[model samples]
Target: MSDVFERYERQYCELSSNLSRKCTAAAALNGEQKKQMISIVKTGIDEAESLIRKMDLEARSLQPNVKAVLLAKLREYKSDLNNVKTEVKRLSSGGNYLSARDDLLESGMADTLTASNDQKARLMMSTERLNHTGDRIKESRKTMLETEELGVSILQDLHQQRQSLLHAHNTLHGVDDNIGRSKRILTSMSRRMNRNKWIIGFIIAILIIAIALILYFKLK
Candidate 1:
């Protein structure tokens, strides 16, 4: 269950990154170039929706309202994307108008020139903001991946240590068994030595008795 959650979280993060990258690229592009990124952005958004639903199912306590809000926001983003696409198409089809407007703006005598410059500045600022946001998200993702890798390394090391301790425990048990066997052998040997000493003493006593008997007989 934890593994499933982890996988879902990873997928959500990856989709978020893909969406951010696509948005950043879209911000800097216009016309066909920007249009080309829309499908990729939509794919990321769809994947994110699926991931969130999976997460919500896993966490029963999760509020459905929150998911609804997220889906609503994604819909808004999609709407905005369509509007931008339409605007790009319109601008691309009006190339002659754009060139004429640029010439007039260069002449520096039209009131529309200032508004155009302002709009361009705003677009540039928006692009920069998107790029900055994408960079931060990318950095955060990289850090997360690194932390996960470190955690895995630590777990592997701990497992190896545990195995080593188990092996050492088994070895100690074997050594203890050998020591017990040696002790039993030593005890048996000690008992045999004691019996041999008693038998030798009895034989010596018998020899002395025999010598005494011989002396008495000779005297008789």
Candidate 2:
């Protein structure tokens, strides 16, 4: 049972580390960055699910109290990953880029895009929440380091660990929201910049046409 617990604990730590990486990536990722994040998330989810299945089997063979705590923690991790999956799907849908370059040009999208920087500020706040959660998880792990027993005390320790996991779960959700908002703002800004480029090009073309007309009339 101790061996199985050790194995499960290692796997759980790996999953948590992967989740933190994903959250960090999501906070700063652009469209291409998002693709990279998606890959990381997918790999992490697959590994976590596999570990969870093994944990379930091992749990069935172990003592009830130990098995119960481990199973509960595993379920929480699974739920957090599933939430991340949903967020990834929403991000990949590209619904946020509804306003094209032409639309931006016609609608003064630069101003609109500039105004959305507030969302960036909000995202920064969300990153703070993630950082706080990471700190909490580290603190919680420190308590486990001092533990010398594996009886009922282990159950209480696991409960504290679960609370730390919940913090991580909440942090990930905050990251997902921030990422979605940031993606929309970025896509809008890109479209606005493209529109400005087109406008400048058109102005240059008009100037060239005016020069040509002037030369023709003067020579005639």
Candidate 3:
């Protein structure tokens, strides 16, 4: 679902960008060139409309929270598309208006009106470009923040793993210490048992000698 949405969304952005560039190019063109650009713009508008429909359909099929976000984005994109269409229509009309007024070129008022219209068109184009730049900046900031959050989460996971490893290392050291102590205690016990055996053998030898001496004296 998300993949489809992103595909359509990416295509729409590209289409819109193409249309914007064509529109800007139209401003500097005339005669056959301008006519061809206008044709391209019309076709792009149709493609844009189709993409919008696909996006809207995918958005509606999504979960409530996600759907809401997509719908809002769709609404904004629709407005931007409308703005592009309006600008194209304005350009076409401006061209026709200039041609129609060719006969009145000698009139001062006609010249002033023409200059004013041209200035207004340029101003509108500048404003549109400015708005697009602002939107791009906002998107960049959002991406940066999301990246930072992911980085922080990864760091937290690493810290927890490090702590667990440290605990295991300490436990092993303690076990080694206990094993050494137990070995020393067993060695001390073995030495005491050997000394007791020697004492018992010496006492038995003295008893045998005294018994023999008493027997000999009785016989004599």
- Best TM-score goes to which candidate? 1
Deviation from native of the Cα of residue 72 in model 1, angstroms: 40
Q: Which ranges of candidate 1 are over 4 A from the true structure?
A: 1-119
Candidates' RMSD to native: 14.3, 37.9, 15.8
Strongest candidate by lDDT: 3
TM-score, predicted candidate 3 vs. hidden true structure: 0.46
Tens-digit per-residue lDDT, 109-220, candidate 2: 3466663564455445545665687589668856653542243356666766887999999999999999999999999999999999999999999999999999999999
Q: Each candidate's TM vs. the true structure?
A: 0.47, 0.39, 0.46
After superposition, candidate 3 runs with Cα above 4 Å error:
101-220
Which 10-residue span in candidate 1 carries the lowest summed lDDT?
Answer: 88-97
Error of 3 at 160 (Å): 46
- Put the candidates in TM-score order, highest first: 1, 3, 2
